[model samples]
Every structure is written in C-alpha cells, then in structure tokens.
Target chain A: MRHTISVLVENKFGVLSRISGLFSGRGYNIESLSVGETIDPAVSIMTIVTTGEDLVIEQITKQLNKLIDVIKVVDFLEIDHVEREMILVKVAPRKEDKPEVLQLAEIFRGRIVDSGQTTYTIEITGEEKKISAFIDLIKPFGIKEFVRTGKVALAREGTRKGK
Target chain B: MKISGAEILVECLKKEGVKHIFGYPGGVVLNIFDVLYDEKDLQLILTRHEQGAIHAADGYARASGKVGVAIVTSGPGATNTVTGIATASMDSIPLVVFSGQVPTLLIGNDAFQEADIVGITRPCTKHNYLVKDIKDLAQTVREAFYIASTGRPGPVLIDLPKDVTAGMSDFVWPQEVKIRSYNPTYHGNKYMINQAAQMIAHSKKPVIMAGGGVILSGASKELRELAEFAKIPVTMTLMGLGGFPGTHKLSMGMLGMHGTYYANTAVQNSDLLMGIGVRFDDRVTGKTEAFASHAKIMQIDIDPTSIKKNVRVDLPVVGDVKNVLRDLLKTLKEIKEQQWGAVRSAWLKQVERWKEERPLTYRFDKNIIKPEFVVEKIYEVTKGEAIICTEVGQNQMWSAQFFKYDHPRRFLSSGGLGTMGYGFPAAIGAQLACPDKIVIDIAGDGSIQMNIQELATAVINKLPVKVAILNNGYLGMVRQWQELFFKERYSHTHLESGNPDFVKVAEAYGAVGLRATKPEEVEPVLKEALKVKNRPVFMDFVVDWKEKVFPMVPAGAAIDQMIFDEEKEEKKLKAVK
Candidate 1:
C-alpha cells in the first residue's frame, strides 16, 4: 500500500538527509516525493509517497516525528487531501498544425510559455492523472521534451485539526 | 564575497573540512584545479589513472567514515572513474566524485572531451547533478557532500560544465536543501525496538550476524554490548569481519564461502538468527534455500530494499544499527551468563574440533612458496592488528580465510563489485585515514596490473602501504575454475606472456620492491617491508601454480558439498592405514 505523508520540517542543513536516511536506513521505499518551503520563512513542507505495510508506515511516522527539526507528520491517506503536480511539455509544432495545437492547449487550460519556429512549450498544472492524460493527448504531436514536478500535496480542511 | 563557481567549489569543500582530494587535471577541470592550487589548506594528490583516484577517494571514505572527494575531467576521465564509483555504490561507501563536462554551449555537439557523465553515472550513484547554472554551484557542492555522507552512505557525482565552473556568480551557500524524496529514517521505533527485544530475550540459541553497516554506523561498541548482554554469539560477513573482536570467546569467526565450519554449522542449527546491518549476500548464505532453515530470522538494516531482497524476516527493524541497538538494550533485561554457558561450551567444542581437524595450513618448502603459507606468515607478523585490503580473485579469498580479523573496519575489500584493482589505492586511502595503523594490500598478479599506475601516487605521497602480490603466473581464480569445471582449456587465463616484472615496476615508481621466490624469504621480507616508515614497498611472492583454495562448495552447490584438497583427501586415506 502507498501512503502519502506530509511533513513540516525545519529548513536547515542535513534535514533532507535526516528524512531520507530514515527511509534508506530502515529499507523503506519512497515511490514519489516533493518538498519545498511553504509561505513560512522557517518551515519546509515535504510530501512523501511511499509503499509499505501498516506497520512500516507506523514505524516511518514514528521515526520522522523524532527528528528535532521535524514539527509534524500526517499520513494524507487517512485524511482528506488535495494533490497537485505541474508539468512542462515542449512539442514540435509544424506550421500547418499550429492552429490545432493551440486549440488543444486552450481546451486543457494550458498556457504556451515559449514559442519557436518549430516548437512550443505548454505548461499545465493539475492532479497527476489529469496532467498525464493531457500529455498523452499531446503525444501524437511529437513531444520534444517533458518535465514533471513529482506530486506535492496538502490535507483538506478538518483533517489537520482532527489529527 | 562574489566568486566564480570553481572558487566557490573550493570554498564549500573547505567548509566541509576536506583536507585532501585525489584526481588528475585536464581541459575541463583545469579551472577548478587552478583555483584549488591557490587554496593553501587543501592538498590535491594527482593520480596517474582516474580509476585509481576514485578508488583512493573511496578508500578514504571507508576508513574515515567521511565523504571521500575526487575531481576529474569529462569524457574518458569521467568514464574511467565509473568502476570505482560503482564499487563504492555496491559497498555503500560515502564518496563525492566531481567531473568537469564540456561548456554549456558545446554540450551535445560532439565537442572535444565531451561525455554524458551524469547520464552514464546516474544508475550507479546514489544521486547525481549537472550544474547548468553557476549560481547553483555552491549549493550543489554542499548538497552533494550532505547526500554522500548521510544515511546508507554511497557515492554521489556532480558534473560541472566548464562554463558553469568559470562563470561568475555571487556565491550564496544555502542554509538548507529541500529534497523531499531523499528522506532517511534514523531513530528506532519504541514499539519495534520492544518487539525485537522480546524476540531476543526469549530465544534460546540466538546468534548475532553483524555486517559492514555496524562499521558504517559506528555501532561496534553497541553491538558488542548487545551481544554481551544477551549472551548471543556473533558471526560476521566478509564485509563485517573485524566488526567484532575475533578473539572474543563469543565470536564465531567469519561466516560464508570460506567461513569456518563451526560458524556455518551454528547458523544451520540455531533457533534464531539476529542479522544486524547485513545484506545476507549469497557468499554469506551458501545455498539460500537451505540457509538457516531451522532458524527464525530477525533482520535490522537501514536500507529497506535489502530486507526482503535475499532473506525473509520474521521481525524486521528498519533504523540505524546504533540507535536501534541502543533502544533494544534499554528495553531488554540482561541475560544471565549461566544461561549462555551450556550453549557456548557446545559451540566452542565444535569449533575447536573443526580447527584441530582442518587447521588452516599449507606445506611450503624452500623451492615453492605457497600463497596460503605467505598469507599465514603475514597474519602471524601483523597479529591481525594491521588493516588488510585485498584485490579480487584467489588472493582475496585466501586473505579472508587466513587472516583472523577481530575488530571492524580492519578488513577492507571490494566485496560487492569484487573489483580487481581496488586493493592498492584503497590501501593508500586507508593508510592516510588511519595513519597509526599498518595497512597492507594483498593482491594477485593479474589484479595488480589493473591499477598498478597507483605506485606513483603511493611513492609521491609517501604512503606506508606494503603491497604483497601472490604471483601465480595466471589469473589464479579463473584458472582454478577452468581447471576444475572447464576441463582446463586455459584459453586466456595465462599472464606469462606480457606480464611486467612487478618488482621492477615498483622500483621504477620509487618504491622498494622485494621478490620472494622461496617460503623462507616470505617472512623476513614481509617483516622488513612493514618496518618502512615513510616509503611504500611492494613484495612479489612467486607462489605455487597448482595450489587452490580448498573446502570449496561450488557455486549453487549445497553447503556440505565442499571439495577438500586432494592431498588432504589422500592424507585421510593414509590415516585409515
């Protein structure tokens, strides 16, 4: 089973390691992870999606909670949450296909970040599945390059205080 | 102060307290080396081969428990360091390898000295980086160090394009890095620790199997205390050898392919096996299906991938060995010495009997110097105190069998990758890290030639490394296999045609060289070699050609199905007379 854990850690040197060391040292697998500083100056939020049994997740949570810099750990699976991911896709756009490419971009609510004579960069943000579906739709146009920010998540209202 | 990425790299290295870097210079790396030249406190030892430089760095990392640092040029230089980087990755040694790539504009253009170093090394390294911008250089250097030295330590590579290194940028060292995917667990769960303690407390014939992680985690003391407290006997993997005092009564010596008979037997019969910081490699468990069949296994490791990779576990504790052991000790009650006495006596008796029956011995007359005899003599002289680093092939196994390592980190070798040329450079690093201890590299004739260029580095640095080569005139390990299983076709195993005189090679490199053709000369030459304080020495021992490591259970064969030496078999026949 995969569990998404949201952690608020002190933004400091070696804190990234303290968290990852817990996984590698204990033999846990983090399938997908994304971390970034929140609006707060001193706090960083890390969303980690890992696969393990209930016991393993409990152990991971307990260990993460013990780090001096870590303020909290919440398993998103147990709570209502909103997950978002951003993806950038650069596709080769033929002169004849420019209108069609723009039409599809407008349908997906994506923005053309850059344009060249032969290519255009499309930026989209949504749930992972939605972005993946959009990339699949654009695959026929020939994707020159693609980059995705591995999913970052936050718990929905009522879940934070309940935990 | 504002500085170039190249200078910031040096500054970050200074902050990390790095005193030495082993590498060579080339076009792309010149700017970094140029700035490094101005840094008075940092010392750079240029190696003839990039592979040697990386291995030396890895050796330093293993010995010091700090991240070993190396720098090299792009393309061939970066590719050359792959084997060493892979070796460190497999063994989980902490290392930071920096390579210079072509400038940003020249990338992907088939430019001079260009290679996709980051892409090539991504699979091998724990993490890798390609500095596209100069502004990220300081933070990248800092994160590279932080990642390399932390949790299940392994090699990390930073590929800096020449433009980035030379580009101007205001250096701002990031106070923190936000890498979410790389979180590592450190503390042991109180619940799991208590559960583990309960398992240990109730087990009747429990054994502690310590691996190299004990050394990495610096948990040797805690491990010893746990073993002593629980009255559990300790056995070690090849990588784990020296983690426990070999002379300790509770120590079961090494367990594996060349492991002691008693240790294997105990593992076979034990009721519970407590594996700590071990990966349970195939060598340690002869035939996995049959390995510890009678025992319930409790595995403790920091890497989760290793837990079910080889052996199944009834109780798995995923945390640092030191922390987990500390918590377990706190929760568990001390075991009575009397409770362990009966089991210890029986096991000891069995070990003593095995030792008496097949004492590690080989007959070596003045005419033909046996490799086993030479190894035994080296052990006799060192009293197992000196750190022994070995190259791959027959000599490596011989050293494992002959030398009795009682403590951790004393027996260093490339076990996971089994890289042949690892010994000499690794010894250089180990010697530098532990200056007070004597370090020896036991290498084979074929394995030594791979990285023999390190002779220059050793001589120039005045590293007191004693290189003992078991020259069998053949790739002894492969030759043995061909002789045993391949009907002795002997196609490419011979090294008689183009082999360099190692003594002459060492001498040419400004190191003392000794050739021991007879058994009588082995001990005296070894003693003299060890006496050298500042100079490095290489001793080439002309060992017997037909001699092979005995008690060999062929790969995939059952544990008990071991091939004894023919002479020993004949001796058994005569004993019947």
Candidate 2:
C-alpha cells in the first residue's frame, strides 16, 4: 500500500536530510517528496509518498513523530482529507497533434505555461488521480520533459487523533 | 552579556549543568578549545579517539541518567563518531555531540578539515544542527541538551563552524526550551491500564519482560513491585539486564538467543505478557511468528512506535515506564484479595522444572581455562557489586549468562549496534559517574584491540576500571560460525600469530597489567585487579580457544529450537570433511 504522510518539522538546517536519512536508514525508499515552509515560517512541511505494508507505514509515521524537530505527522488515510499535486509537462506535439493537445489540455482544465515552436509546457494542479490521468493523456503527444510535486494534504476539519 | 560564539558555547554547557566533557581537539575546533583553556568549572577529559570519547559519554549517560556530552573536530574527527552515535541512538542513551565544522562560507567547498557533520550524523542523531550564525549558538546548545535528555533519550549533534565560534553574540540562556510539535505522553491510557490489571489478575501464566527503559526511566522499583504483586516471572533483553533482580526466584534470567531455556519457555507459554520498556528486538523475540504465541501481550513504552514495530500486541500502553508502572500498581490495588501469586503456583512450578532441566552450564577440564569459567569467577570475585560493561561477541554472551545483575544500571552493553570496542571506554565513563563504585569491562581479545588506545585515557585519569580479557586466541564467535556452518574453514578469524602480548601492551600504556593462563589463576587475578586503586588493571586470561558457546540458536531458527551442544555439530562436520 502507498501512504502519503504529511510531516511538519522545525525549519532548521539539515532537517530535510534528517527526514530522508531516516527513511534510507530504515531501508524504506521515498517514492516522492515535496518540501516547503508551512504557514508557520518556523516550521517546514514535507509531503512524502512511500509504498509499504500497513505495519511498515505505521512504523514510518511513528518514527517520524519521534523526531524532536518534527511537530506533527498526519497520514491522509486515517481521516477525511484533501490531497493535491501539481505537474508541469513540456509536450513536443507534431503540427497535426497540436490541436489535439490543446483540446486535451482544455478538457483537463490545464494551462499552457510555456510555448515554443515544437514544445508547449502545460501546467496542471489538482487531485493526484486527476493529474495522473492528465499525464496519461499528454504522454501520447510526446512528453519531452515532465516533473511533479508529490501529494500534499490537509485533514477536512483539522482534526487530530492518536497524538 | 556579549561574548564570542565559542564563549557562548561554553557558557551554555555550564548552564546545562555539565560537569565533565569527553572530547578531543582539532583544527576546526581551535576557537572552542581556546575558550576552554580558561574555563575553571568544566573538566575536560581528552580521549585517544573520537569514538572513545563518544562511547565514554554514552557510558556516562547510561550510568548517571544525565545527558552525556562529546566534542569532536571536523572531517575525520566527526566521521569517527558515526559508529558511537549509532550505538547510542540504538540504546536510547542521551548524548549531546558537538562537532566542529569548517566556516559557514566554506561549508560546501572542499575546505581544509571541513566535513558535513550534520549531514553525516542526521540519521544517527535524534536531531542535528549546523549553526551558521553566532546568535543561534546559545539557543542551539540549550536545545541540544534538552532534546537529548528528554522523552526517548538519544544522541543530538550540533555542528559548530570555526567562524561562527569566533563571531560575537549576546549570551542569553534560554530559561525553557520548547518544541511545538514535540510532546511526550507521560501517562498511559487509564482504561487500558485497568484492563491490563484485570487481565493479569486472571492470567494463569503471566510474565514481565523488562528492558533498558526501566533503567532509563528509573522505574526498576516500580517494575519489581508490579512483578511481585502480579506474581509474574520476569525476563529481560540484553539492554535490560539490570532492570530486574536476576537473583530473584521469579526472575527467568535473560531471554532470547543467548537467554536461558526456561526464560524462552516461559514466554512461549505465557498467557499474559506485560512488556515494560522493551522494544521486543529480534534477539529477544526470535521468530516473531512463534514468539509468545499464547500470550496476550500488553506493551508499555514511552516511544509509541516501539509497541508494534517488531511484534503485534493485544494492548498498547504508551507512556513513560515509571509513570505507567506507577499507574499499573494503583490499578491493581482493588484486586488485592485475589492473591495472583497463589493462582499461578502451577505455572511457576513448570518454569522451575524448565530451569532445573536445562540450566546454563560449562565443564572445566583443568587442562585449559574455559571462557565461561573466567566469567563465572569474575562474578564471584566482584560479588555482583561492580558495574560490568562488555565488548560484543562471545565474551558479551558469557558475561550476560554467567554474571547476574541484581540491580539497575549494573550491566551495560551495546545492545543495538553491538559495537565491538564499546566496553573499555564505557567502563571509564561508568566509573566517572560513580567514583566510589567498582567498574569492570569484560572483553574478548578481538574486540578489546578495537579501542585499546583508550588505555592512555584510563591511565591518565587514574580510573581504576578493570579490563578482564577472555583471550581465546581467535575471533571465537566467528570461528564457531565457520566450524559449524562452513565446515571449519577458519578464514581470517584466527588472531594467534599476529596478536600482541596483552599484558605487555597494557604495561606500555602506563597501566597495571596481569595475566592468568591457568584456571586457578582466575580468582587470584580478579582479586589483585580489585585491590589496585586509582590505577586501571588489565587481566588477560588464556582460555580454551576452541570452546564455543552453547544453547545457541542457529541463524533463522526459532528461539525455542536451540542447539544445546557443539559436540553433535562438530561430529557431523567431521563426516563431511
């Protein structure tokens, strides 16, 4: 099973390495990780996606919470939550396929962030499943370069449990 | 109060109530060392190696229940602390390690003696910092100590750059350090505590598995009370050796790989297992699938993750060990008339039979001194009063099996990392914690050589820490493996030809050296070593090199399916050869 864990930690030096190092030490690999300062500037939020069994995921969350710098760990699966992911994809469309690509972008509610003679960089921000579906459609147009921000989530009512 | 970062660092250490620091100086830490030259209240003990300093600090923390402090230089100096940091983290020993880094401006550049100490130590340390600004130095130091010593205590690193130490800053001591996201649950769920009490009140076969957390939380008394009141047998992990009285009749002795047969059986047959402060490590649980199969386990620990990390439990009580035990005792008060001890008589009788049927034993042929015999004699000589530390491998097992601990914090070993050279330096650190108490390092020839240079540190400090070397002439544990599993292909396990005379080496380091080659010499050597005060003594005992530890559980085997003798295996190997 894949678990998306939102880890809020003190925005101190080497904290990212600490979080990532913990995973590596435990022999767990992070599928995707996106880090940025949270609403509290003193703290940083790390949205990490990792695949593991129920037990392994539990250990990961518990160990993350054990870290002194870490403020809170929220697993999206535990409660009603909203998950969002963003991706910027540069698609090299053939002259004939350009119209199809634009129509697909419009259908997905994506924007053309950049445009060149042969490539159009499209940006999409939505739920994780929607972005994945959008990428599947864009891949047919020949994706030249693509990158994504891993899923970040918030509980529906900011409810806390098992603290 | 304006002061340099170096001065602020020293001041913060003083404010943290640090009386002693175990460290070594280097180029990157010159500024800090320069400031230390004038500090009168703080005592600095220079160790031969950075690893030794860290181990010593670890030992100090384990013994005194205070956060140990270690300071090392940058690059190689910081690199050397990696093993010690891991060892401390695994054991949950509180430690604050200060590593000197290159100036902030040249941190990423390949400057002279510069290393990313914070990056290197990130995983091993509970938390780490690479302070670039002088203003953050004071608060960082305070936070380092606070985080290291609190909750599930572990090592924390603070990387100090040379320029930051030289820079000026206002030295303001933070009155209280707080982390918004870090709050430890001190009380276990009350409903669960009552349920556990009710379960224990009815359990026909009950057991208590205690670990180092009992010692860390100073809950040994509470644990003993709970076990006695509930009439449950007690077993311990390697790190939990002294958490309960090994000499007590209800004590099942150490459990798991090198554990007593009776202890393992009791756990397998247990109806209710109240695990106090133990992580249920692989060594203790053996095959987790088959471990305590009949028991409805209730795990009590401060670290929530430890509860189900290795094995699942029926009930989970998350809190500090002392607090949980105290609450448990109170919950059990209502069932005082039940007399749980009277109900579990039959189970206790069964355990006693198991203890008598297959006790830990060794035969002394008199032709050669057995390693187990040496440990047995050391125990007799010490009267179980000494704080015993051990280097990893066979000697460690022998000590755990032969020398019983009847008090808390009396037995120390690198349970998690199993660092080979941990014992000697750790002994010195333990000695420093209890100046009037006798401290000894039970060692093997192979592991002792790992940090033999610490003899200089021990001698100069005049710590009467004794080192009892079980000189088996081979990496006995590895040799045993090759003989049993690989048809006696010794490989590089033999250290006979290249080995130096241990006594002579000890003498060279300005320490008292003694050798006991015969079985009768064991008692005399131990007595003489004990007599020498303010001077460390190294006693080397030449034991049967081929003698292997018994009651061994083969790799990947269930704990219950242990091989009790070596003769059968050796005979089988001979047929193959």
**Global lDDT of each candidate:** 0.85, 0.89
Which stretches of candidate 1 lie above 4 Å from their native place?
A1-163, B176-178, B334-338, B342-359, B364-366
Q: TM-score of the candidate numbered 2? A: 0.96
Error of 1 at B151 (Å): 0.7
> What is the clash count for each candidate, in the order shown?
23, 1
DockQ score of the complex predicted as candidate 2: 0.78
How well does model 1 score by local distance difference test? 0.85
Give the lowest summed-lDDT range of ten residues in model 1 chain B: B334-343
Q: After superposition, how far is residue B552 of candidate 1 from its true place, in Å?
A: 1.9
TM-score (C-alpha) between model 1 and the true structure? 0.80
Instruction: Please give, for residues A1-163, the per-residue lDDT of candidate 1 as tens digits.
Output: 8888999987865578767877887788887778899898788999998989876787688667645468888888777889988888999967788889888888889999998879999999998788978988889888999988777887787755444
> Taking the tens digit of each residue's C-alpha lDDT, what string does model 1 give over B1-577?
6788888898889888999899999999889999987789898988889999999998888777888999999999999999999999999999999999999999999999999887677657887778888887888888888878777888999999999988888878788875554667788777788888877766776778999898999999999988887778888887887888877877877777766666776788778899999988998887888888888898898876667667778888888999999888878854333455554556556655765666555666668998999888998998878889999989988988788887677888999999999999999988888889999999999999999989889888888899999999999988999998999888799996788888899889899998999888999999999889887999999999888876676888655556778887798899989
Docking class of 2: medium
Give the number of the best model, judged by TM-score: 2
